[model samples]
Target: MISKDPRKGGLAGRVTKLSNSEQQNNPLHGVRLDAILEELVAKLGWEELGKKINIRCFNYDPSIKSSLAFLRKTPWAREKVEQLYLRTTKKGRK
Candidate 1:
């Protein structure tokens, strides 16, 4: 069946992808990984973040440049950082 929404002119159920505006609801949306790292380090500190995420980049000689390089190549680590960013920001607001 065709989608009633003109933005999605094709079949409705065929794909359930979110558009850019819809994705703004995501906490990480439009947030750069480097920015996320800086915030985490500022809020949690590298030692604490390493304890939480258990990654060498955060544990030893941690720097945003190095951490970002690692996170970019490693999906699992990047996901961890994004999750922590969301959690940290939520707590900050409350």
Candidate 2:
């Protein structure tokens, strides 16, 4: 007999298939922004990097979508983010 619990992973398999549709279309498969940000933050303290960058998204409540949108239009801000990313990674190696 099938289980009747609504939360028993009823749609996960179907949702996973739907989610993977976009990945199949992209050459870069599963590149995710959160993973990148997490690595950056792990290496660099939130305050150190956030203040240096000075973008509202990074300084205040940061979201991947907002940060991406803000960075796309602001070259300087994007540069800061990239630079911070590099610095954080480099520091982590030492």
Candidate 3:
């Protein structure tokens, strides 16, 4: 049942609340793509990232700007990068 009044938390308000709650358990919730790339590069370096994800952006003439552009345009590559980040962060915590 959706509330009619926005002040009383309508559909949009409910969605916002749900989204905020869901993000609490999500590793990438508050992380930006550039920040993710920076962390991965700092921890793994471009060579290892290239080897792990096999993306040309990382393997050939890698720069944060180039990588961010490519990843933003390419969904599959972005997913790989995000997955690698989640894995790396989890490992670091242990």
Candidate 2 Cα misplacement greater than 4 A, ranges: 1-36, 91-94
The parts of candidate 1 lying over 4 Å away from their true place are 1-18, 91-94
Which model is ahead, 2 or 3, in terms of TM-score? 3
Model 3, 39-92: lDDT tens per residue?
Answer: 999999999999999988999999999999999898789989998898898733
- What TM-score should be assigned to candidate 2? 0.47
Please provide, for model 2 over 1-94, each residue's C-alpha lDDT reduced to its tens digit, 9 standing for 90 to 100. 1234467757333323335666565432353445556666666656666777766887787766777788767767766766566565543244
Compared with the true structure, all predictions reach lDDT values of: 0.81, 0.61, 0.83
**Which has the greatest TM-score?**
3
Between candidates 2 and 3, the one scoring higher on lDDT is 3
User: Candidate 1 or 2, higher TM-score?
Assistant: 1
| Decreasing lDDT order of the candidates | 3, 1, 2
Number of backbone-clashing residue pairs for each candidate, in the order shown: 0, 0, 0
Give the TM-score comparing model 1 with the true structure, all chains together.
0.73
